[model samples]
Target: MTDSALAPIDALLRTHIAEYPGFPTPGVLFRDITPLLRDAAALRTVIQHWKTLIPEGIEYIVGTEARGFVLGAPLAYEIGAGFIPVRKAGKLPGNPAGLSYDLEYGSARIEIPENSLPAGARTLVVDDLLATGGTAAATLELVRRFDVEVLGATFLIELAGLAGRDQLPGVPLTAVWTIQD
Candidate 1:
């Protein structure tokens, strides 16, 4: 959608997102979308915007562990695609494809369950938020293990100026809201 067309949704999202100062740690501000998730109209609006960004023939939506599941599952259902979770280390049931990456404070790992997406399946990576992109990048790598074609990545919100998009490199990225940090 055009920038002007998205203004109302953008404004709606800005109001729905609650801010918490020094959350999870000191010196960090957190953007919370729980309010948006609770409001059906707001949630539907977000899904609609994201749906428009999706390419045809997306076989699956691979969501990051936790919040991604919240967003991706519905998008997958709406788009008639399967949903796969990129889990944190040891969160999967079987021997899943895994990738280790470095976070701001330490190292971390994410996994995609074995036999999740068939080879050559077209997939989209999705998440609630994109900050530093360490987790998102690792999730992308883990999804690639299935040998599927990644159509693109999408986020409900992107914390701009952190260069999270840099980690994604050549992938097409669409964010419902890009918040300057």
Candidate 2:
């Protein structure tokens, strides 16, 4: 579906997202997006909405490992751009540049191959959610190490009170849905 035709995207997100309170920890409410992924209409709306947020002329779409991979690949195909996967520590086959950061519950690392993209390639980063912004910031740093310009970062949803966007100053970020604390 065309980007403009995705006006119902917000409703689709609300319908399919599952809320799990105290998940992975006490006092933490996790907004699970797996339900949205399972629903064909919600999934399509998410991709289309995010595609609309991406500015034109992006050469590469970089997605963090795991969940990012699922969203980024289709977005890359839809926008006719190249896809680059930023994987976890030691998961990448080649010598990769890695960045370490703290998540809400624990610390984690993300890696990207040194040669994933040519120098100065424009890249758009995609992820399933934006919580504390640690992962997103690390991914951005990893992309910068390759000398690629980060066009923007896109997410299916954002937890507003977490202030994730503060960590990504000067980088464009777009979310189809946001949960206010």
- Show where candidate 2 strays beyond 4 Å: 1-7
Candidate 1 lDDT over 1-181, as tens digits, reads 6789989988999889999987867767778889999999989988988898778899899998788999999999999999988888898787878888997546988887788899999999999988898888888888887788999999999988788999999999988899887
TM-score of 2: 0.92
lDDT of 2 by residue, 21-89 (tens): 999899888877789778877688678767877789999999988889988998999999999999999
| TM match of model 1 to true structure | 0.94
Cα error of candidate 2 at position 171, Å:
0.6
lDDT of 2 at 140: 93
User: How far off is residue 129 in model 2, in Å?
Assistant: 0.8
* Per-prediction TM-score: 0.94, 0.92
